[model samples]
Target chain A: MEEGCSCIYSRMASRFSIGLLMILAIVLLMVRVLYVIYRCGKPLPKGVSQSFTTLIVLGSGGHTAEMLSLLSVLRKDRFTPRFYIAAATDNMSLQKARSFEDSVAEKPAVKEASQFMQIYRSREVGQSYVTSVWTTIVAIVHALWLMIRIRPQVILCNGPGTCIPLCVIAFVFKVLGIRWSSIFYVESVARVKKLSLSGLLLYKLRIADQFFVQWPQLHKKYPRAHYVGCLMIEF
Target chain B: MEDRENAKRVVFVTVGTTSFDALVKAVVSEDVKDELQKRGFTHLLIQMGRGIFFPTKCDGADGSLVVDYFTFSSSIADYIRSASLVISHAGSGSIFETLKLGKPLIVVVNEDLMDNHQCELAEALEERKHLYYTRPHTLYQTLKKMELESLVRYTPGDGTPVARIIDRFLGFPDD
Candidate 1:
């Protein structure tokens, strides 16, 4: 009778241990997510300097146009060594960036601005969640390698799925005391009511050094998001 | 207008980067095929995205409907610029570019799209007489009355606001 009782007790103890482990795993995940969400401090301000190397992402089609409009208006000497990041299959973005460079090249003045731009293509993500996860993992690895090589002082991107891995990497770098690469997240003009997936992730994780919105309504919706009007290059 | 008349007799149909099966199906329908031929569109180039349905090569035996299609193209700006007429899914990327290029554009709003703000945009632009707006289901009817001359010249922005933000961010105050 004692032997059967002990056997039953051992079975119950094993089940209890499994339940405890599940709870422990869930709790750890929650805490880690919350930490990532709330631990980040506000962005550090930096004066504009010629030595500042800026990295900006052009997310395929519309984002490419926005990038062009934004880039065209800047003073040529402000951001030295500007690097443009785009997705691998986004040849349109690359073409637009190249053509923008060409436009500067054709100009008699500020010809040096054309030479400051560099383009890099990251892995293209698909719509499927499963495939996107795999591509994102690969992209994270690639972005880590690029961050190591580029060592950019500041990184800026409008909403795109491709921005998440790099922003996360920037967050990791900031956390590790390895480098202080400032990240700026700009929500696209098209998103009036809700944040895009990239915006949501950055907002929830509190990863961006600065967050900008195109509309005032969005600014009211998210107190953390800054509103500085819009940047649409529409007809 | 004279330039459009002299441009190549090609109709460019782009679904942007998203698989829009409804738009593709409507384009290849027998009615649309016949109408395009009657309108002197010598070629129909469709960027179908990942859409499964594609019309077979427009063999002369099947009523002079020359069809060419691809799943995706990274750079279709030239296709948008060079064509006599542009048919597109109402993605802002396509809408703005088409408007900028002053192409005769017909935009179909995918009603099922989650952020189908495209529908509202198309309606606004249609009211402004910039482009032809049609829902996917009603595309055939819209095409029946389609007139390229009806498309209005879109007013271009000064591109000042975009420059301001970047300059402000980079420490250059607006001039």
Candidate 2:
């Protein structure tokens, strides 16, 4: 009788430990979810109004100049624009981009260098598809961190490479009821394959309240596209 | 030609990221080199694209020509300004920059003959009498017949398709 009772006790103990571990995992997951919500919930700090805050430009190389030129024109009002150039590893274009950003900005600018995005040059291989997907994840994490810190009202994307991931973060913010912030897509769909990619990409972009395109050609490709005249240099 | 009257006539050969075999064939051909040498060209500058495996050097049979390679240079615009003739890849950036400098240009397209966006650009400019173009197979024949005067009258206006796209980005009329 005692042996049977001890056997019952051992079984009960095993079940209890298993149950305790399961409860612990659930609590941990709940805490993580709450923490994410809390972090996402926090508003931009006092005096860091999205309207007057600096815009974070997220590309390197010649494309950086294009964005800088756009920012130069937009700096006429009571706002200060800053830049964060996402450069490739050991690229001359990265150096040129940094120098250009330094020369243009009136105030001290913010710059971040990472090998998070790069253009695939090979035609025989389809490495870009995989690289692009991975880049999207990294960009989202980086953008989330930036959003928590800078809290800019708008994030302007000039390249499809980094813009895709940043758009995902913007979507998350939209879901959390952060309606004041906006995301912008610069380039238009030219090829059919690119159009299909844009269709999948549009899910992330639905969070963008305003969508701008340079050409009327894109209207046939993307029905929801709004024609914003090209961003030209005033000088 | 008059734009760079002070500078000697320099033929810029740029076989962009097309095929190295095509470029080698174009350069090795006797007719094209002989014609260029006869023109009293002062120098030959080659912007060999990515696929070129060897260093650029003089190749004329007469051994009187000088060839220079430009890989990556901060002074590309200055070099373009100094050149009497600008030969470039059919890539939009090169095409736009050459036109922006108001220099005589010769574009070589990379299309697989069937799908030819570059060929289209070349034909449109050729119709406008703005530039010269040659297929890989007929490069020598085309070069021998190209009239320098026909190319001199063509100058591309301000900005390119990309610049126009930017203009549209800024909300300017496409026209």
Candidate 3:
């Protein structure tokens, strides 16, 4: 009878210890998340120089145009070895990107600095919701693979649905201490009053390191977003 | 054919990548054509994207107005650059491209599109006197009332400020 009572007590003690460990782990994770969020938008402790590989996500039409405009003004010499990712379904965006690269890349170094990659869109416009679930999984897997391969130091994206997966993977990498790819999201000039779905997700979740909006109204709406004025025009 | 030496006053109308049938229809109507001729626009070029409606009264129409249109162009920059006036759908891409070129622009907002954020951009630019915005039904009136001389030239926004912020975030010292 004593042996049976001791066994019950030991089992209960082990279970209680396990539960306590889980709670402790949860608290640690919460603290870590809070710390990471606090560090967002601040300069990195160890800043990288030269050989900075940047990953640029290009959406179709307007998004691509806006992103290209932003890149036109960015110091290309500083951000070298760019990897441009576009949706497989979007044929024009990467072509435009390549042309833009060619236009800006006068030297051999800048000329050889760009590579284009295509990923499947999570959900194409007008696609049924039922089939999109499978595609979204496929897209997430592809995004993970690309993220691991590129391991970019900096990521730049505007309002594009394809960017959501890549940004999320980068955030996970940040949380895991694998890579700290600073994500910079510029809300499209078209979105004045409301954030796009991708922008809202990254903003609410604090995935993007720095969020920029073209209009002052968006800056007012999303206090965290930097009001950088319209990005479409090149000075 | 009338005067080779005189610069042809071209008015470019772009619907961008999406099909804006209402915009295409409104721009090509007889009233709009008459207004174009009255305004001394020698040529009218329409970029009708995937729209089923094609203006039947194009090319060599009895009057001095020469109307031509294509479904798509590899690059519309050249067209926008050469145009004296630009009539465009309220797509932000189209709006900025025209404004950047310093062309007198009239933005036609397609009300049919759901979740249309195009109006916000169009209205904002219109408020700034960078361009004019109107619905398809009122495009003719907007065109008639447009004061190209009064329209302010758009001063291109400098990306230096944004780049500086990015540099700071990347821990690069400002030069």
Candidate 4:
């Protein structure tokens, strides 16, 4: 009789675990659907009729150069009260940004960035999967902090893997009525043929408010993304 | 394409700060050596830069001429100035430097790199008649047909390309 009771208890425990797992899966799916519905095939346009607060994500190396070029293009009064964000290890970007700002300081129409701060890198494309998961979680928390702290009206980033977590957090902010931020993702000019990993993820998942491709070929392929000409004319 | 290799031409094979064993190996291979020798390149100065492999026996190392290599040197600008033909990894710094000097450049893009941006840059320049480019495996094949004098000088653009499109994107008055 005791053996029969033990077997029944084990079965009940297994059923409870399975039910909990099902609920978790269902909840995850619902959130994903909500996010998708919020993001995909829908253009979140924030008309820049007047200057608004801007957050620009700067990736290391080429991305820094490209963003600098973009920033160099825009008038100071247009993207006022600018905030620059980069990965903590990207000292090169910081130096370049500082020098660039200094170079443009002499101009009357330049509105310098309010602040440029570094955040921890989420995960590199080639890093191990396990470490990537932990790093991504930490990145999300960091991004959440920035999103909450800055509450930027518009966020601009080129195709960088580091931008993903921050943009995802922005989506969470939007969905939960925490904040409203427009994400403008520009695919780098170097991507002649296809959307980069970041661009691909943002495109398929419907994360970016405006997705701009430098090449018309890429625009032809994606159709949704705009062809904005050569961001880097050298390339 | 003279057979007599007395060395007016310096072939600078620079890996540009990073270790590129594939590029080093390809440039040092028998086919590449023979091509360089045939092209009258006297000295092959390799800025190997942390690359493990070295040329087993340099082209004409037995007194006629020699191949020189260094781990790292700050004299990259000096090398680009004198090089008859520059073969390099598709690093932007190296590319721009070589372009600025108006030297014939053959860039070999590192296929194992995390990004293909460098490759795109090389292709664009190649399209614009600015430089010749190759993958590591086909280095010899590409080098065989590369024209030294025909490579165009690079022109840096003026400051106004970024404004109009950006203005449009920002929903600002596109003046």
Compose the digit string of candidate 4's lDDT tens values, residues A182-212: 6778887667787888899988878787788
**Candidate 3 positional error at A160, Å:** 0.9
lDDT of 3 at A191: 89
- Per-residue lDDT tens digits for candidate 1, residues B1-175, read 4443464388899998778989888888888878887888877899999788876766444447668888877578888887888999987788878888899899998877775755755666787798899988787788889888877887665546544544555545446
What are the per-model DockQ values? 0.18, 0.07, 0.67, 0.18
How far residue A58's Cα lies from its native spot in candidate 3, in Å, is 1.1
Cα-based lDDT at residue A114, candidate 2 = 15
DockQ of 2: 0.07
Model 1 C-alpha lDDT per residue in residues A2-29, reported as the tens digit of each score = 9999999999999999999999998977
Best by lDDT: 3
Candidate with more favorable, higher lDDT: 1 or 2: 1
Docking class of 3: medium
Candidate 2, A34-149: lDDT as tens digits:
55444432333433442343344444333454454455544322233443435333255456545655655456533331112233221212446767677655655665665565
lDDT of 3: 0.88
Index of the highest-DockQ prediction:
3
True contacts kept of each: 0.24, 0.00, 0.66, 0.22
**TM per candidate:** 0.67, 0.59, 0.95, 0.71
Q: Evaluate model 4: give its lDDT.
A: 0.76
Which prediction has the highest TM-score against the true structure?
3
- List pairs with backbone clashes in candidate 1: none
